[model samples]
Target: MLSSIKRFLIGRPLKSAELGEQKLNKTKALAILSSDALSSVAYGPEQILIVLITVSAAAFWYSIPIAIGVLLLLTALILSYRQIIFAYPHGGGAYVVSKENLGINPGLIAGGSLLVDYILTVAVSVSAGTDAITSAFPFLHDYTVVIAIVFVLFITTLNLRGVTESASVLAYPVYLFVVALFILIGVGVYNIVTGQVSPALHTPVGTPVIGISLFLLLKAFASGSSALTGVEAISNAIPNFKDPAPNNAAKTLVAMGTLLAILFSGIVVLAYYYGVQPIGEVTVVSQIAEQTFGRNFMYYFVQGTTALILILAANTGYSAFPLLAVNLAKDKFIPRMFTVRGDRLGYSNGIIILGFASILLILAFEGQTEQLIPLYAVGVFIPFTLSQSGMMVKWIREKPPGWGTKLFINTTGAVISLTVTLMFFLTKFGQVWSILIFLPLIILIFHRIHKHYEAVGDQLRLTTCEPSIPVAGNVIIVPVAGITHVVEFSLNYAKSLNPHQIIAVYVPFEREEEEIFEEKWKKWQPDVRLVTLHSPYRSIIQPLTRFIDTVVHKASESDYQVTVIIPQFIPKKGWHNILHNQSSLMIRAYLLYRRNVIVTTVPYHLKK
Candidate 1:
């Protein structure tokens, strides 16, 4: 029944050959990969205002300059990642680039940072989407965490269905969002140019609590840095594109960057012209829509699409996290299960893990986008810095064609990215200190996992020597609770193994029970020997295992093997099995790690 439900939800298993068909064209790829970067426009400008407004209402004027700073940084990152795509077309992103050019530790740091950032991307995007919904409806404000988690689950399901299907479903909303925002921006700009709306210059009404300084502007820039969080996703997911993957991915990156810049700049400009503030329960975009279109269909339409694209922005994380995890798994930095593709050819394990991790963050931060924003920029910028640094190193060492230009781009990106990272740490360290702890913890875990895999590989490695000799013979032991058809079935199966000897052992709790069982066994005979073990404390497993240990020790000394046959009876229904003690299961669990001990189960199905 569970398998049937799974088939219904994700569809039938896709053949391996169908994998190539799942690669996305550029249009669909944009929707899948660029949603996070694009959706940031919904809240990125607001984040800048949120930080600046703390000084005083007059400080809101700094938003434009800070936004420009973020945009410049975004341009540098986009160019750097394009170079990343051209160089590492196989698509490991920063992790692979850093590992190859820098070293293994730097590679793991890059991988770990990106992994955490991907998780936060889902959390922050979904939470911001929820904020949009709550802004429109108001009543949903109470269920913000629940709504965010449900969106995560929905996106996770779509991704598990496969890449092409998710892209098709998610692409329309992203494009719709772009159209809606452009209409809002175009009309808002028209209003400003027509002298309908004037610049919102606020005069000082009282003493400023905190005066505007360079530190404050840096804080605001770091807040808006969320705009660039998902820019690396395209480079991380080059393999997900159609044929000519790297070229297609790079072109899509440029397209996404262009749209993001236009939308982000337009919204920021409109916000300044209209004097939009981070009002309670209402978003900056929502306020802009209300100002431009009032509470009409266009207002609701803009809100609806903003909410949708923001939610679907999680698709960026869903698309890239699994691909990055696959790279780490290949290097034995993470578990091998992450590399396993599901029936739909998606990395199912990675997708599910990303979903749960996002839900956890949403719950931890109570689905408040403002609270989660502080932790968001650091994770992304760490990888951004590492990726750019890795590319810079690659150019210097390899000195490939056009290396100077590539080196300059990456160097600028790395410096700006590192500056932003440090700014986030210094300005928002109170809220973001946990990231400091988490980054190193994640890297340590990666090393531990890698070490374990190395140890396992060494142990399983084969040499050119001859194989060891086989055991002389088999000594089988069957543990019986009582004389019954189940015991008889196990004994007959043991005899078929042609063992040197077979012992039927029983554990009796009381003297009277032992005598009665012995008398019955003697009468039945059956040409087999029976040994009885008395348990003074009524411990069945201990006494039974003790007897088996003695037999195994003797057999091993004689160059023989020991096989324990556990006799079990199958009930007509699954619930019926719960009514009986599961001795067979217990025995199997206890003997699981015992070396040189073979265990098998013989089932006697009950007719009724």
Candidate 2:
């Protein structure tokens, strides 16, 4: 069922050879590594407004402080994570840091938290962007599922082609976003400062009612502070950066962090000065954009640019989530499958899984950024806290002298991030933070369970002596329906065993048994015995399986050993492969459950 679901979500797996065909440069590196941080643009405003909705309306003014907080936090996170890149140039982000400094369980917590965050990142970013887009196009109002799937499928295809392919495709749009945001926010803020305000700016920005106390204010700050959720993707994707990984990673981190700060901070100021109300308003962003450049062309351009950049923010999850999964898998905290290179060598399976899960989230949460925000912040902040904690431990352990300079920065960042995390847990606990706790605990418990299972399996597993003469050479018993194919191969293998006796068993379904017997007699025969079993229901596996048990029982009673040869056909095409007998599949499963029966697949290829 899981396999079927994976197929439906990601399409078929491609050969590893295909994955070897792609590579990355600076331009492409930016795409994969910069996406998560870029995606922050979509919901940063919404998160700010959401927290302020219930508190005093003056909470909206806090958006500026929170935006500044994000910028400061983002800058610290980038520099610290740059140290992380230098410390461990390989990608894997928080999981790597925690695993190296702490342990596997801690690593699993980091990985699971990041994984959930990635999924929510895509869902929230896309949904928030879709909300903006839907305002402009009424037809998209209810087609969220369609839009989400299209986005997922398109991203999956781009990823399949390879990381470089998707990055290149996204580069221009990301650049466009950078320019558009810089321009829109810049012009809007300029207009506000210059007193060249539009008609919408004529209304009161919002009436400041001061009812919520300082505690509520701090909680609200924590809530709005989630704008920095994707800030750490740069660290995780450091390995994907171009050569001189430390340099490139630091440069990229600075670029992303600086740009994000400007955009987030500018938008906050522009909205504040221009009366861009976010809460209890219909199409707040569109209202602001339309108001900014009232001309049809410029207004449409601003709105379109904002909407596209927000939508593209999902590219972050698409690029980094898989890379993080790959790291966890390599560490053996997750399944080995996560570590295996996909056709694109890009952790393609993880990418596809995140894509679908995000879409499912979009559908389940109805694409509401407000609804998914709680689930989103919980996972992201856990890792942020753990990562910083781990890094602090590492820095302390290493006792690097220069670290004192940045100790205050890391110190403040870690404390602030941790405080926000505690606030987030306390604030969002009832809504959907339940998922965050459940998801990580599940991953933690699962890793523990898998370790237990592995230990037990290793204990129960028996080591066999390879090709040792077993007191006596076992009787080689093989069943065949045809001549000159698997039968020939089986006969040759039986000779290699040099068994006490070679027994060829045949199951005849029709009355032509007599004729078939004569034909078998005429065929090349080993210096052993041949037995034929009759099946009335035209069934192959069950009867053969039963006969094997009988032979094994007989051999044991007579103080002998036995081996079974299950013939397998080498199918050239997929359809022919399925049509061929599946007896081998069933018989292998059955025989492996018993004692002292060596079952083997004797493959025979069809002649061209």
The predictions' CA RMSDs to the true structure, in order, are 2.3, 5.2
Top candidate on lDDT is 1
TM-score list, all predictions:
0.96, 0.83
Give the per-residue lDDT digits (tens) of candidate 1, residues 458-496.
766686254664799999989888879998899989999
Would you list the C-alpha lDDT of every candidate in the order shown? 0.89, 0.71
The C-alpha stretches of model 2 lying farther than 4 A from their native spots are: 1-28, 55-59, 198-208, 279-283, 444-471, 480-498, 504-547, 550-561, 568-581, 592-595, 603-608
lDDT of 1: 0.89
Winner by TM-score: 1
